[model samples]
Each structure stands twice: as C-alpha cells, then as structure tokens.
Target: MRYLAHSAHAQLGSLWLSCVGWVLTAMALGLIQWRVWLVSDRGVISSGVAWVGVWRACFNSHALVTPGFRVMHCRSMSLAETFTPPEIVAAQVLMLLSLVLGLCGNAGGVYALRNIYFRTQEDSPVRLAFFTTGVLCLSAAVMSLVPLLWNLISVVTNQTIEFPPEFNMPPAPDSQHVGCGIGVGMVGTVLMMVSGIIFCTYRFPVRSQRPGGSSSPAPSVSHSRGAAVNDNPAFESHEDL
Candidate 1:
C-alpha cells in the first residue's frame, strides 16, 4: 500500500509539472506580443514560437504531438506506493482541479470582455481577439481531465493490482495520456496569458486625485446660481438696501 501511494504521488507530481510547463510555454508565446513592441530583434518571432512549443511539450503530457519515440526503461517502487487509497484520492482531486481551472478561466474571460464593452467603448481589437482566444485555450485545459479520470477509474477498480512474489504493481505506460494533457495545458496557458496582456494594454490605469492639488474644484449647481446672483446686483441688493 505504501509503495503504491508513493508511486502514485510521484506520478501526480510528474503530471502536474507536465501540465504547468505547457501552460507556461503558451504564456511565453502571449508574452511574445509584448516583445513585438519592446524588442526590435530580427529572429524573435520564430524563436518565440519554437520556445513556446518546446516548453509546452515539456510542461504537459497531452502536448506531445509524437509519443512514438518514448524510450522503454525499468523502474523501482517508492515508499508512498504502500498507500494506494490516498494516492487514488489525490489523483482524482488533481484531475478535478484542472477542470475547475479551465472552467473558471473561460468564465472570467467572458466577464472581462463584457466589462470592457460596458466600461470602455473604445477597446483595442487585438485585446478583444486575444481574450476570445484565451477562453478557448482554457477550455482545452479542462479537456485534459479525461485521462486523469480514466486513471482514477482504473485505480478504484484495482486493475493495477498484482499477486504473490512479484506483487510489484508498476505504473502503466501513459505516453498518450501525458501527451494530451500537455497539449491542453499549453493551449490553456497561452490563452490565459494573452487575455491578461490584452486587458493590461487596453485598459488605461485609473489615476487617483491627489488630496490637495491645484486642480479646479468641480462646478456645482448651487455655486453656479450663486455666481449668477453675484453677476446680477439686483438679486442681492435687498439685504443691503
């Protein structure tokens, strides 16, 4: 049980890193937009895409477009492998969390767009487009939950259990699963970052008024009327008269 738990934990960690890495890659790509404005280098665009793809693959399993090249290797069991129940639970939780992140991201993206429409009539097209793209990417991230769910089902059913002397229950090969996960994570991360950049660049920072400044006071109706009376001496002369 302890060995199973330990192995499961390691798998979870690996899964998480793969997803995060892909997302980061996507973010880096979105950041590329900023680079266009900030950097004047020649090869930045091509390099940025390459970097994004590489990182995306690194971070998430699903992003791996080609998994036929995975090398076969022997492995050993760890201490946590002994605790299978908790391990299964942990896997389910992680999978659920990923799905939630995707849904939340999409919802937030829509809200941001609505806010932009209501608050600012003059919004940049670039930002708006990116916001839309971000929502889609987040949706992809949510789709990555499929394999995790499958893994959970397998664990619950005790399908991985082995018997007798060679009771070592090794982790099943997960190349396809991991590849899909990485891809989804990358797409989601890219969209999210793009949305962020769009919001930041398009939305002008609200400046606060200083406590005491030389700026003119807001004109009030009463003040205006008082000034009118002052302009017309007849309106105020009754008291003096």
Candidate 2:
C-alpha cells in the first residue's frame, strides 16, 4: 500500500505541471476576442457590420462600395468606451480576474510540483502549495466563464442605439452576432476548467510511510539452559529435581 500510494503521489505531482501549462495557454487565449459582431439596424444601403473585440472595435460599411471591393476601418477602443457598457465592463473584469488567477495558479502549481519532486520542504509547504494551486485554478475557471457568457449574452440581446441625424450613422442593428473571439474564449474557458479539475483532484498531498519500515514491535527472544534431545535430558541441569 505504501509503495503504491507513494508512487501515485509522485506521478500526480509530475502531472500537475501539465495542468499549469494548459491553464496558462487557456488564460492567454482568453485575453483575445475572436468573434463579436454587431450589425447595424439601418437600412441595407446604410447598414454596416461592426466587430468588437477585447482590445478594439472595427467596422465595415456596405453603403460605400466600389465595384466589388469594400472598405474597412478599425480603431482602438478607449478604456471609457470599452468599460462603459455594463455587460462589457462585467466581462472585462471577469476575464481579467481569470487571467490573474490563472497566473497565480500556475505559479503555485509549479512551486508545489518542485517541492514534491525535489523534496524542498519537509511536508507542510508542499501541501500548502497544492492547496493554493487548486484554489487558484478553480477560481480562474469560474472567473473566465462569467465574462465569456456575459459578453455572449450582450451580443445576442443587444439593442440598436439611436444616433442623431448629425452623426449620419444608421440605427444600431437589431440582429447583433457574436464573433470568433467569443468562440475562442469559450474554448479557452473549457480548457481552463479541465486544468482546474486536475489541480483540485491532486490538491491534497498523499502521504506514505517509507518502504520496508514498520512500527510493529520486534519478535521476542527465548533463552533456556536445557538440552533439546531427550537422550541428552539426563545431562540437563534442573537442580536435581
């Protein structure tokens, strides 16, 4: 039992490094917006497509076309513009938390794995490292999901905002569509969750006694001054009983 348990524990420690790698990958992907599209509600002639991402916003107009080509212009979104919308703000915060937590989780997992394989600390530190890794990875997954869902919801239920005639832009589109960014983010979320499960499962360190070691008492030794053979019994000294 001890051998198996110790072996499994060591294997798990090594396994967690992969979890950290996965979590880092997911978190990195989560930072990008793959597919968020907004359609203009304006008439077809005045209608346009707008693409929003975590870092910037882009738009293409169907109104102005030369022969067969269309023009597209992209602009970096300001913090105020990116954060003004309630849903956007919520998503921004959640995704940020996910990234931060993922970083923390990776750090903790690496620390723990090192401690386990290298026997850096006696016992308590490694346990604490595992616990921290689990908590952080779990937190990162949860945080990632919130923003992914929120931003997606915002895309589907979004209403067209009205603009004055002076601005000359069409009505906000009724059928807003999600972009590839959101899809990629969703995928990242799933990966993050998988990593979280691994971290959580191995959070508790498995302790085992050293091989060939036992706490049981030693066998007793008996001493006698008598001969073993009956023929030699006569020679045995029994005080002339």
Candidate 3:
C-alpha cells in the first residue's frame, strides 16, 4: 500500500540529511578521481597506464618489473591535448560546473538538516531549508552527470582522440578501452540520483482547509440538554402549576 506524507516537516528534514551524504559521495567519486582507465598494453613490457584522470595522464611499472616498489609517471593535460577536435570544450566546462554544484548542494543539505533537527518549532523556515536542500541536490546530480555521460559516449564511439591521415605512430592499445574511472563516476552518479528521489518523494505538505473555515463544524449537545429538561417530571409539574 502507498502512503502519502501530510504535515511532514520532519520527513523533509531527514531527506535533506540523506541528500548531503549522496551529494558528497557523488562529488568524491566523480570529481576527484581519474577520468577513465586505459587497457594495459601487451606490446609494452614492465609498464602499464597509470590511470588517466581529467587533469592528468600517467603510467606505472608493473610490480614484477620493479618488485616491492611502485613508480608512476604523470603529466598535466591541456585542453588542446585532452579534447578531441580541440574545439569541443563542453566536457571541461561541465566537469568544472559539477564540482562547484556538488559542493554547494552538500553544504545546503547540511544546513537544512541542522535546521530541521535543532529547531523543530520553526516549521516554515525548516521546511524552506529542506526544500532548498532537495533542489540543490537534484540540480547537482544533474550537473555531475554531464561529464560522466559525455565520457561514456566518447568511449563507446572511440572518439577520445583524433588522428590525421599522416599522423603516424599508431595509437596505443591501452587507449582503445574505457578505464575504471568511468565506472567510479557512474557509481557516484547513481548515489546522487537516489538522494534526489528520496527528497522528491517527501515534500513540504500543504495544509488543507476550506476557504470559509473548517470543513466540518463542531457537533452541538444543546438538543440533548433540552430533552433531559423535558423528561424531568418535577420540572413539568412546576411549569403546569
């Protein structure tokens, strides 16, 4: 059976608190981690791709080659190098936006949850706070998705980089496959979406009342009092006298 929330300020409060965790999880997974993983190149010995994050590219030596020690080589990527066709800057911009929005959403959720928890009497104010948190969370989740989805499309289309006919030096096999970072980002995205769903399910309840006043008037007992007076024999005799 489905139940609806009515006059549920507390429900909104709890939803905001949950939103905070989801927003943070998504941000941490999607924004801070690498962009994608690169398949290990069989042609290369003692070396594999380090992990390609949005801002940098790196490579690592296998443990068998260096035993007991790990080494990684990395370099920062410029917009020209990172994006294919060089003119496509949407991915970069969307990624930056997601980071900012995620932080804002997380902060908003924390503040709203606090208001709901600490100041139960402030119904209107607390309700507003929680609603705001929910909106922020929902928006942040959307913003974070742009980069992840963009990357997925690119990987599936094999469009990470473009090569001219004479560019030579065949592309590395590792570059052909999508990386682990994409999966991590997707997981984060799912968490954010779940938070949004929870918030949406319970919202600021509307007070139901008729324009004239209450839907039903209070019951009257005057008729019962009159009946008792009529039934009293002494009162009837006195009236007749």
Candidate 4:
C-alpha cells in the first residue's frame, strides 16, 4: 500500500502537467476560433479561403466533439469512464472531422500567404500576426492530444488499470515529458495572445480621402485667360445678363 501510494503521488504530478498542457492548448484554440469568427465576412457565406481560412481552420472546432472542452477536462481529471465509456465511435468521428478542418485551414492559409507574396510585393502586418497565431494554436492543439494518445495506448495494451498507480518509473528526462508539453503549450498560448494584440492594432489603410482634403496641389491656370474672361466687356455683359 505504501509503495502504491508513493507511485500514485509521483504520477499525480504528471497528471497535473497534462491538465496544464490541455488547458493552455484549449485557450489557444478558443482564441483562434474567436478571431476567425470575428473577421469572417458573414455576407459572403463562404469560409475565408481566399484569405487565411485555412489557418483559421487549424483551430476551428465548432463541429468537432472529441477533444472538446468537456471531454478534455474529464479526461484530465482521470475520469474517462465516468464520461460515458469513452464514446470511441463518436470520438473517432470528431477526431476525423477535426483533422480535416485543421489540414484544410492550414493549407488555405499557406497558399494565401504565398499568393500574396508573389502577386503583391507587400506584407500585411495583420496577416502575418494572424498566421503566427494560427500556427501557435495548431501547435497547442497537437500537444493537447498527447495525454489522450498516451492513455489510449496504455488502455489498448492493458498495461495498467489506473494511470495514477502505474507508469511511476524513476525520475528521468523521459519522465518529464509531460512537463515539457505543458511548457511548450504555455509558450504557444502566449504567442497567440501576443499575435492577437498585433492583429488588433494593425489596420488596413482607408482609400477614400476626406471631402475637402487633397492629396496633390491644385492645378495652375493661365492668368491672362482668367483676366480676359473677367475683364472683357463682352464677357462682363454676358455675366450681367
């Protein structure tokens, strides 16, 4: 019992690391989803494919059910069974959907970036920021699945009934994998947040000038012609009439 308790204690720290990693990853994904929704043109009725829709899709999860907020939290708590028997079929479906969206969104964004660079010799600060953000969110999303993958493998192999009491090997670099994941997730989250700030601050230049404003000097006229029109007796009579 003493050894089991000690094993559980050591494993609990790793569990906490997994929870932290998923939480950070979730935050990034949520931010990416929000940004996409914020900038999408509702009237167009199409995803922002011509722009950075692919990048936006990297974190979009509106239709996905697996690796969702609820499932992640439950699993992080080591309550997989308590959450309706894993829902393997449903989970698989959601995972496939997520994978498709993630791939599409990323591809679209990369293509857009290349198109912009080749067509217009200009780089938009906002697009760069958004792309950076999307990449970070994607990284986080991938990391978020690490614990689930580990657990799934363990279950399939029948290595341990309870993760908390098993896999308590002695301290080593591999043992700190969970910690590294959490750290990387946190970094990704911070990058997304900073990118969000940059995105918000970077604005496109407005085209139309103000009503009374001029971008160039007024054109010059022939002074003699002006004088003739104003001073000629014939023109003066016409003006009077």
Candidate 5:
C-alpha cells in the first residue's frame, strides 16, 4: 500500500500548481484585454484605443467627448451578431470548457491528496484518483492553449473584427498588440501541464527482498532428509529387534 518515497511531496506540489493554474485560467477568461489596439489620427494627439476579448470588446476615446476627456465604452459579444469573429466564438467556447475541466481537476486532486496524506485506508484507490486528476488537468491545459495560441496568431497577423458603428470604433486600428490576458493564459497552461505530469508520475513502491535475510529450506528437501534418516540401518536394526 506504500507509495514512492517522494510521492507525498510530489502530490502536494501538483495540488498547489493546479490550484494556481486554475485561478490564472479563470482570470484570463474573465479579462477583456486579449488584443489591444492603439489608434491615432493626424488632428488628435491621443485619439482612441480599443481592446477585444473572447466575451466582449471595449473602446476608450479621448477625442469623441472633449479635449483631454476620456470616455470608455464596452459591448458584450453576441453569437447572433455578424460582427463577432469566428475566433472569438471559438475562444469563448474553449476557454469556458478549459475552466470547467480545471475546476474538476483541482477538486479531484484535493481528494486524492487528502486520501494519500490523511486517510491511511489500504483499500482507497489513490493511484486511480491521481491518474484521473492528471488526465483532467492535461485536458484543461490543451483546451486553454488552443484558443490562446489561435488568438495570438491572429494578433500577430493583424486580424481585424468589424465593430458596429454605434460602438464608434474603427474596423482596423493603426497597430495592435498582444495583451495581458493572453500572457496570463500561457502561464496558466504551462502550470497545468507541469501539474499533470507530476500527478501522472505517482506510483506504488516496489517491494524487494533483503540480501542478508535467512532463507528457509524447501518442504521437499526437509522431507527427503527425514526419509533418509528413517531408512538408515541403525534405526532399521532397532526397529527389527
């Protein structure tokens, strides 16, 4: 029923990493700064800026109101709207799925760790629990990574999404750059992978015989020795007499 010598430490490490990763993933999903756009016009020194995310887009315009006055507007993305890009839809779906999986993994990991450290029950399926946790964490990592990478590629390629005229945003900005959300997502994905690998490494300790331990004679050998002594002439003579 014993596990590897370092199994306890490894399990604890995995639990912490998974928990942090889950929190980071949630933050990334909620943040609306996946891509940042910087806008500038000839007449205005500081014109406007916009940002887009999986769930929404926001705009900050200084020239629209008054000189040196900044106004910020945000719009919730709708799947029914034609302006919503396919990438945003995909990101939304995948990020949500990843968050859900991460939550499950964290719960399973806590249960497994509790059984390993607190409950000394030999019948507990700690190994299976660890394995399941690993699978869930890795799946979450993959799900989160796809959208993060896709959005990063789009940002690099200067992909644009058409904003409605009411939002008062340009179709394309003068320049665009990756935002904090993507960076956080990348870090979270990496932590998830590391935690999963550590969980998967948990294994039962192998039992090995000691070299200096005494060995007992086999039953067949003991029986043969007894028969030879009984058949000896000295014992037979006594029996016959």
Candidate 6:
C-alpha cells in the first residue's frame, strides 16, 4: 500500500511542534518567575520586587547583616519548609512529571514520524506508534496545564506566602501578577495538545492510480482459470470430444 506524501508532511509538522513544546516545557519548569510581586514603595523593601516559582523564590533586598546595600537574593524552595505553599509543591511535582512525559513523547514521536516518512514498517505498527506518541504528548500537556492553571488562579486571588526575615520580603506585595514562566508554560501546553491531536488523526491513504492515469484492478482466480482454459488448444479439443 502506498502512503500519501502530504500525510508524511503533516506528521513532520506535528513532530516539529511537539519538539518545540517539549523544550518550552523544560524552560517553564526551570524558570523562577512563575509569579511576580511588584512593590510600589521602595521604603518598605529595598528593591521593590519579588518573585516565586515552583523550585525557588527571589527577592531584591538588602543583606541581613549589611543593611546599607541591596542585592538579588534567591532561595531554594523545600516541601518540608512551612513557608512554602501547597500549590507550589504540587506545581513542582506535576511540572517535573510533565517534563519527563514530554521527553518520552518527543522521542517516541520522532521514531513514529521517521517510520511513517520512510514507510519502513507495516500499517499496524506505524499506527500503533502514532497512537502511543499521541497519548504521551496529551498526557504531558495535561500534567503541565494543571499546575499552570492552578497557579494562575492563585495569582488572580492574590495568594501570599510567608517569607523568612533574612530574605527581607513582605508576606504579600502591594501588587502582584503572573510572570513569564507561566506564559511560556501555557504556550508549551497548547503546542503539545495541538501536536498530539494531529498525531492521533493519522491515517494511511488508499492505493492511488497508476502512473498511466488509470487504476488496475486485481485479477480474480476464477477469471484467470477460465482465460487459461479458453486459450489452451488441448482443452478445446477435449471439450469437443
């Protein structure tokens, strides 16, 4: 059976999109600006800004001992810490899981697309590969999306986290908003979903017409036997007898 070139092209496009989504997801997972806090008055805090992410939190503030100068201070987040919010901990776990699933999905997608483009395997194996890749990609998308939406809601509600004194940040800032990390994560999730749908929709094209601009039908066994009998002189003589 012959496959259509357009189908291969579509698979290639989805593969590229999925690869990009995987990279973006990793970026979002590592980014430390999931939520940004804007300080209107510098008198309260030296640098007038702070941000928190799944893995860490950062603040622009004066040092604990040297109060005269300010610097960007970042601290690693821990689930054991009381100041860390449950939402952040969940986000951290889910985002990491999403990254792992996305990696596997990208690898499987590449293998499937390569087989499809080269027509290396039977239809069944190729179709199965596509299905597996689609499932993985979609799963990854959902995993990443949960945390992103949850955090977005938290930001909308203006949720606050307790900060230690050494970091020199307020429990809540004067104003807060979503950060670039969420934006990037949202984009990546969208791409992953689109690619997965495309992968799932794959279908092998029907046999096409021959180069002579006509389709040749397969000859039946009964017709071939009848033609052979009619063409054989010995069979005709025996029939006459």
Best by lDDT: 6
**Judged by lDDT against the true structure, how good is candidate 2?**
0.57
Ranked by TM-score, the better of candidates 1 and 5 is 5
Off by over 4 Å in 4: 1-112, 120-178, 206-213, 220-241
lDDT of 1 by residue, 1-241 (tens): 0112221232233234334534553443223111011112223121222111111111112222234433211122232455333333443344345545544554554454444444434434524643553544444444443433444354345443221223221222111112233344345444444443333333333444656753466666555776888888787897478
lDDT of each: 0.36, 0.57, 0.53, 0.34, 0.82, 0.83
TM-score of 2: 0.65
Kindly list the per-residue Cα lDDT of model 3 for residues 54-166, writing each as its tens digit.
65444554432233336544444456663343212444565566556656666765665555445445455555655665666667667667766776676666654533322
Instruction: List model 6 lDDT by residue over 1-241, tens digit each.
Output: 4564566677778888998998998999889899999887665456777778888777665543233435666777887888888889888888889988888888998888777666656778887888898888999999999989999999999998888875567767888999999999999999999999888888887767877777987666555877999989999999999
TM-score of each candidate structure, all chains considered together: 0.27, 0.65, 0.62, 0.30, 0.80, 0.81
Q: Rank by lDDT, descending? A: 6, 5, 2, 3, 1, 4
Candidate 1: misplaced stretches above 4 Å? 1-91, 119-178, 200-202, 205-241
Tell how far residue 166 is off in model 6, in angstroms: 3.3
For model 2, the stretches where C-alpha displacement exceeds 4 angstroms are: 1-35, 38-48, 60-71, 160-170, 203-241
- Per-residue lDDT tens digits for candidate 2, residues 1-241, read 1222343354364345435545544544444343343444544334345555655444555554333446544444334662245555566677777777877777776776666655534655666666677778778778867766777777677644333442333455535677766676666666656665665655343554455675555679765644343346565555456
Worst 10 residues of 4 by lDDT: 169-178
Clashing pairs in 6: none
Better of 4 and 6 by lDDT: 6
Which pairs of residues have clashing backbones in candidate 5?
none
Candidate order by decreasing TM-score: 6, 5, 2, 3, 4, 1
Between prediction 2 and prediction 4, the one with superior TM-score is 2
Instruction: Give one digit per residue, the lDDT tens place, for model 4 in 215-238.
Output: 565778666877988878899888
Q: How many residue pairs clash in model 2?
A: 11
lDDT winner, 1 or 4:
1
Error of 2 at 196 (Å): 2.5
